[model samples]
Target: MKLYLRFMGIHFRSSMEYKASFFMLGIATMIASLGGLLSLTFLFMRFHTIAGYTFSQVLLCFSTIVMSFALSEVFFRGFDRFEQIIRGGTFDRMLLRPCSLIGQILFEKIEFNRLSKVIEAAVVLAYAIPRSGVIWTADKILVLILMILGGVMMFAGMFLLFAGICFYTLEGLEVLNILTNGSENFGHYPVSVYGKWMLRFYTFIVPLACVQYYPLQYLLGRSDRSWYGLLPLAGFVFTIPCYCFWRIGLKHYKSNGS
Candidate 1:
């Protein structure tokens, strides 16, 4: 933990050295996030509800997922861009260090700019929470928090999986973006609104719905199942397989020595 904080502080100080670039990137990210929110707003203006979900309800879902994705981007960005580290021979240098590989990768590049999305998500939540008409209780609040945490884990797992794939190919895969960034772009609304098959795929395969859809039903008073609130915990299982794949990839890695 102390090492992690030290790395974070070092990165923070380094980032601050280029304050203009840092703030520019942050503003750009924040604006990009707001574009999605504005699109939703325009759609809601045209039709007040989407698949029977009120605009505010959808906003809640949006805020939750976006917040989670932002958190993952901020913390796990090294994994997301691991191909660069591999190509630059940074991974090999890390292997010679006393620190854990995961720790080194995690702290390699801390993109604080991604916090812009988090701030935008917070603003959306502040606006949507009361208007969504969900009664807040301790359990419900806990469930909401879990939903965000589950989404973060799910996204981090995807980033790890992407990094692992690079070990064999030694190049970034664009198609996997469909699962990472693509999910975030389209996942603002409840998964059920897409289709039964989409919902099933997210639930059983990627477990995106486990964090966003199933538990959201309970949060929105659409379902009375208490178990629904706990479904987000199931999403954590996604990390196990991703981690296993990463280990396998690490074993097979043949460094380019760049």
Candidate 2:
């Protein structure tokens, strides 16, 4: 962890060299994230509730997913841009180091600009938590923390999957956005609002509802199922397959040989 922190400090100093550009991109990211919030606000103005969920409740869900995605982007961005690293022969250099490949990849880049989205999400969460009418308890608080952690892991797993695909294709796949960015856009509301099939897809296939919908129901006191609070933990299982796939890809990797 100390080494990781050192890497973070180095990355921070490097980013700070271009302070104006850094702040400009951060502000742009924040504004882009706010566009989603504004769309939600306009939709609620037209209808009192969406699928029986109040605006605040929907905002809670939106902010949770956004926060999770922002965390993933900040930490796992190396995986997102793994293709470039491979093409530039950085992967070859990393292999020569004694450090773990995954760790090196994780620390290769730390995008401070993405923190703007995280800050935006935090602001939305601060507003929604109180207005959502949830009677907060220790258990509920723990569940919420787990929900965020699970969401982060799930999205990180998606990024790993994306990286693994790059090993074979030797290029980034734009279509994978359907899982990463697309999921964040669609997740602004509860999965149930999207209809039964969509709900099932998120729950069983992507496991997004495990982190967002099921656990959120328990947090909001909409369900009596105490187990719902722990459903987010199930999302962690997603990382297993992703990691295995990454190993498989590593075996097939053909270095740029620089």
Candidate 3:
């Protein structure tokens, strides 16, 4: 963990070297994230509720997904851009290093700029919390934390899956973006709003509903089942298969020899 922090520190310093560009990009990211919020606002102006969910409830869901995706980009962008390292001969050098390949690759890129999106999400969370009408309790608080952390893990797994695929294809796939970025965009509303089949796909296949929808139901007091609070843990479990797939891809990897 100390080594990871060191890597983060190094990336932070490197990003700070170009302060203006960093701030500009950060502001740009923040602005782009706000567009989703604005659209949601306009939507609720016409309809009092979406699929029986109030604006604040939907905002809670949106903020969680955005915050999670932003956090993943902040820490795991290396996986998102893994093709660059392979094509630039960096992967060959990585193989020669004594450190863990996954760890090294994990910190290959640290996008501090995405912190802007995190901040935006946080602001939305603050606004929605009091208005959402959920009776806050100790367990609800814990579940909320789990929801966000679980979301981060799930998105990180997606990024890792993308990187693993790159080991074979050596280029990023657009379809995978539909899974990652598309999810973030669609997730602004509760997955349940998307209809039964799509909700089932996200729940069973992507497992997004485990982290967001199920736990959200518990948080909103719609379900009294205590087990729903732990649903986010399933999102953490999702990383296991993704990591195994990554290992499989690594085993079959051939050097680009750049």
Candidate 4:
């Protein structure tokens, strides 16, 4: 962990050298993320609620997803653009390092500019907390935080799956936006509102419903037992298939490239 931090510090320093560029991109990203907030605003303006969840409730969900996704994106940016490294022969250099391939991949890119998403989501969370009316308990709040972390891990796994797939095709792909950006689009509202098929996809396929919906059901006092609060932990299973896919892709890379 110390070595990883040191490596990230180096990347951070490199990124800091271009201060103006970083700030500009950060602001641009901030504007785009804030613009996304309006989609939820407009939806609430028309219906006031979805699947029994209020505007603030929806905002809270969005906050968790956007904050966590952006956090991973900022640090794990190498995975986000893994093809660039593969194409540039950087992977060969990485293989020579004593560090783990995954750790080196994580250290290769640190987009400090994406920190704006964290700030923006925090602002939304601050505004939504009081308005949502959930009596904030320590355990409940802890569970809520875990849900955010789980969301980050799940998305990071998706980014890794996307990165690993690049090893096979040797380039970035866009259809993955369905799981990454596409989930961000759907996560702003209650998954329950999306009908049966969407609910099943979120539940069994992507596990978005596990992280956001079932656990949220307990948080809002709509649930009788507190056990539902921990259900988001189930979302971690999504990472298994993602990692398996990554391993298969890695083997394919070695076979075809050499």
Tens-place lDDT digits, model 3, residues 4-117: 999999999999999999999999999988899999999999997999899999999999999999999999899999889888889989999999998999879899999999
For model 1, residues 237-258, the per-residue Cα lDDT tens digits are 8999999999999999989977
Q: After superposition, how far is residue 248 of candidate 2 from its true place, in Å?
A: 0.9
What's the TM for model 1? 0.98
Best-first order by TM-score = 3, 1, 2, 4
Which regions of candidate 4 are displaced past 4 Å?
A: 255-258
* Clash pairs (backbone) in predicted model 4: none
Q: In model 3, state the lDDT of residue 186.
A: 92
- Better candidate number, 1 or 4, judged by TM-score: 1
Model 4 weakest lDDT span, ten residues long = 249-258
Assess each prediction's global lDDT (C-alpha) against the native. Answer: 0.92, 0.93, 0.91, 0.84
lDDT of 3 at 156: 90
Q: Record all residue pairs in model 2 with backbone atoms less than 3 Å apart, i.e. clashing.
A: none
RMSD (Å) of each candidate, 1 decimal = 0.9, 1.0, 0.8, 1.8
| lDDT by residue (tens digit), candidate 4, 1-258 | 998888878878887899999889999999998777987788789988788889999888889888888888887788988988888888878878887888888988888888988999999999988888799989888988988888888888889899888988888898888998888778877688899999898888888887888778888988897777887786577778888988888877752342
Candidate 2 Cα deviation (angstroms), residue 8: 0.4
- Every model's TM-score: 0.98, 0.98, 0.98, 0.94
Error of model 3, residue 57, in angstroms: 0.7
